[model samples]
Target: MTAKIIDKHCAQDGDLRPQHLPQNSKTRQLNLFEKALVPQNGLFIFSAILLVVYAIAPAAVYLIAPVGESFLLLSLITICAVTSMLLGSQISLFDSRFKPSAPRLAIDRRVFIAVTWLIFIAFVLITFSTAPSIPIWTALRGGATSNELSQERGEFLKGREGAGIALLYISTFLVNTIVPYSIVLLYRVKSSLRHWAAAVFFLFCISFMQKALFLNLILPLLVFLAITRKLSTKIFLPVIFGTVGLLLLTTALSLAGEGGDTSNTRSSDYLTALYAPSNPIDYFIWRAAAVPIFTATDTLVVHSEQFGSRPLMGATSTLISSILGIERINLERFVFEHQFGGWNDTANSNAVFCIDAYVNFGWPGVVIFGLIIGLTFRWFKISTDIGFQSLWLIFAFVLFSAPLIGMLLSNGFAYMLLHGLYIRVDRHGT
Candidate 1:
């Protein structure tokens, strides 16, 4: 009877797989292709997104060479990197060939509350130090949207580059570590703690003045709750729709406010044409699914044209340099110098993990990092039960858009992963 409940709860929902029951003695390990069939595993999600955003779309745009004509050289490498990831998924080191065991934790109420308050206070300090004006609060009270403040936001970030402690808190602590692990704590802790956690979470998000804060923070909660049958369908459906509606409203407002500024049109003919949306539905399809593939691709394109056969030799990453006690080189600024004549927050394009790997190790770097990504996601799946497993999407999102080293060390997902591996989920998957 309990098994039936878990099975029904975990059953097929769109691309996600039903949860695997706890394995008995005779069960066998799943193979590579079999793993791809399990979108619930997260390997599938990460690889599929990378294939499209990093490989396919970039390859298509490269055919046109919208921004940099020379980016075409790296197309084959992108394909190889993605392919290596698939192959890497099959080679399991700490491979859980059997179904994961049940996981549970007992957190003291006092400890949980104390940690939540600590994180909340840290978030408040971050907001005041970095953004004194609190743009999102103003927008809530009938002020200009965050979209209108893009230039000002960029200038604020540029101005703070010299402040070491403030920069670390904003760029490393809040983004990469605290909030994410805190989400894990929310999942595992007792219900009495949730109300306080949620309250703290809301203030922290809005304090940051981001419109997408709700989606990033709450969507994972909903996904996990629905999978565990902790939230009822009626409530889940309504909340999901409302969250999406809010996002759409903010995006539409941005589009409406930014008229007459063909600066968007002039910025990159590549993204403008590649994701050329005639309406909101089309615009959203690109925004939610696809990313700015051209930024990293163009960086590589520019790198190839300028440096040619020379890799950065591990200069692009501060994380790498710090551990090795070497000088850090800023590749984004270097790339920007060639394109826009200077490197600032506005000019520096984000180098996602795979591209950063390529920048550091050239062709071989992609394969090594691809294997690491595949292994990492696989670890996230088998090492934990469904609740922690749900965080796969969040980690995958970080990889899809940001650097890997930052996620592992600076952001604290590595420790979070450790926590999941040790604590795990319930055997019945509730």
Candidate 2:
């Protein structure tokens, strides 16, 4: 009976698998051609190839050309990252025994709903308390820019320490991680409340004017749906277009909210500004994707004289600091301090996994980090066999393993490890 429940929940609603077959017989043996056609496999291959062409190739060019030692280092880091992802994907494909299993803990629907409401209410109350005079409607309508919202948020948290600082951390984690996880789980279970909850949470993130927060929530949800086959292959185009449209819309809203010069800008003007030749798509690409890795590499090169190679130190420090509630060494701030002669909080960025690994242990560190990431993805793939429970796994991986800017250093791997323990304890009653 338990197996039947698991199977039923695991089966995609519109899956083409034959309904009359025994559960064991449902595992279809696919030929090479068919295997290649699987959406997941196709996506993996495409990503691997794209990274080589777009990321690695340019870096390679810079290294070979007169771009100097900085470019060479950047290229090496990029190479490490790309190689790790590819290697990880290949490793995952070969490991078949790591399939997903059903959750041991039963999900109480009522408890879920209650917790979600509590979190949402708390989030709303806190947001309002922080920025009491900022009208939600105006924010939603793009009358409030991201800079304005960020400044207000900074003000609210300014000089806050001790319990206040702790509260800020707790609230940030709950809203960003727990709330999104709950929404995805509820939606997977076909809860009617999910739509309303999701809408409210999305708008709330938008009001903050930070794109990463919104993407952090939605990307994982999309990945969950895709892995579960809940998202139809037929609608892939629509999904892509929809996502792009949403990103553009949100960006326009933020731009419009900047006030003064941008407040009265028309929709066309916003679109033009986004796609302008000088600051074309590449501008966003560089700022959002390439610059962080480059900055990390540059920082390492510049500070080569000051700090000797201490590879495992970076990841270890991150893990220990995270556990002890200490601030992880801010590599970005370090880079900015060196480059501009001072650290600016607003100018913060990430040190992608490769740079993080390389800084601590050099080339070997990069390889190790790559293998771990690859194995993690493979683990997520197998976990899909677990039905609804896989939602959390998918959400966690997608949320943390952000492209060009994620790895084990930032508590993502640690969370996965703790979650694994929870699963084991729940299953075996240890």
Candidate 3:
């Protein structure tokens, strides 16, 4: 009965086989593709819970830091947990031939590891060759007046135009992006890692100075790969527990910081800005559940203190200034200034697009945006023939790098749209 129920839940949604999956035992594994075909009630409830939690947490967090942040943390945990289980099962199922073997080799697969490694090396070289130089004057400008400028200087102390710097950034981006993607392709194509040295050499060349990018994306992939290398199950268990502990601790710390200033006066100031509700429950009721229902109600119409137009204008104006041969232009600064009045608020936490998308179009827009993102993931899975061997590392690379790069560039909407569009469907597809 339990098995039947599980099957029903798995069958409730779209294609269950996500391209990036981890290897495991067959009898115990939950193959998302095959399981997706079976009917199951559990998966349906699970997905619903995840989608609901994800959709509701942000609005709730806006009202009370501890309460809302806690919920958000839980939601994030749930997503990762369910995704890992489902993906791992599917990968294990597909690699049934190697289920009993400690170390499996794919002799029949067409996507040889050597070819993928070579392609990745070529990509690293291309990235280095095409990278544009950062302006020296931009680093030096406004250093005396603003402390922010001093930190920016520290970030660019290495100087941007050097061949060494270029090689570093190129190699880092390639390792984080191309190498992992190639690993997925190689796995799906069932290839051997005979050219691992060549691949690593190219990665070393490309990753010289781009330390931040490497940390956020490439490191995660390496960590995942190391954990599951068929060496020791004991080590893998500790690593998993450690990772979860770290995530929870980080999330708790983040919430604690947000809760530091819980003054009523400050709350009042936030309330004034809201033009909506004061409490968490009321805020959700007002914004999500009520506003749409009472579209004709005049009191429900909230006027934002700041408008989105100014940032749009500022971004464009800065770009125009650069084109007109201006001495030093920082488009990000201009955009932030116009959009947020240079405030140190959460509004500045991520790209303006994350907030602006809603400010412009509201909840419907948010849901549509999420659905589009989900579809993009589906497409990425379909187009790529990513194999089970090293798929986890690849997924880690994609998941971490896409968001990190997106956040850094402050291209929230663009981040969602472009990453979704560009992540080729098959992990190893043509």
Query: Root-mean-square deviation of each candidate, in angstroms?
Result: 7.1, 7.7, 14.1
Candidates sorted on TM-score, descending:
1, 2, 3
Clashing pairs in 2: 100-382, 100-383, 145-257, 310-360, 311-360, 311-361
Give Cα-based local distance difference scores for all models: 0.56, 0.49, 0.33
What's the TM-score of every candidate structure? Answer: 0.72, 0.67, 0.39
Per-residue lDDT, model 3, residue 351, is: 22
lDDT of 3 by residue, 1-430 (tens): 1112112122221112332233342224433332321222223433454344343443455456533232343344335434543443334222322222323222322344455466656755664455442222332231222223323332342334556455434443444444444443332233344235434543343232222232332332232233222223443345445544444432232222122223344433332222334443344334333322121111112112223222222222323335656443233333334433463321111222222223233444334434433433333333222222122333322332122223223322232233333322332333
How would you encode candidate 1's per-residue C-alpha lDDT over 306-381 as one tens digit per residue? 6684777676667677777777876676765655565555546555677777777888888988887777677655
Residues 1-430 of candidate 2 have per-residue lDDT tens digits of 1112223333222222233333544454544433333334543644454355435754765655544465557566666666676677667443433323434433354565577678668757775675534433445655566556555544443324555554445545555445665665555455667667777777676664454456545554554444444444444446556656666555555445543343454433221222222222333454544444455555665447445545435433645556667557666556657655766664444444566667766787778766766655555444432222333333333322232223332323444433433333111132
lDDT of 3 at 352: 21
TM-score, candidate number 3: 0.39
Query: What's the lDDT for residue 260 in model 2?
Result: 37
How many angstroms is residue 89 displaced in model 1 relative to the true structure, after the best TM-score fit? 2.1
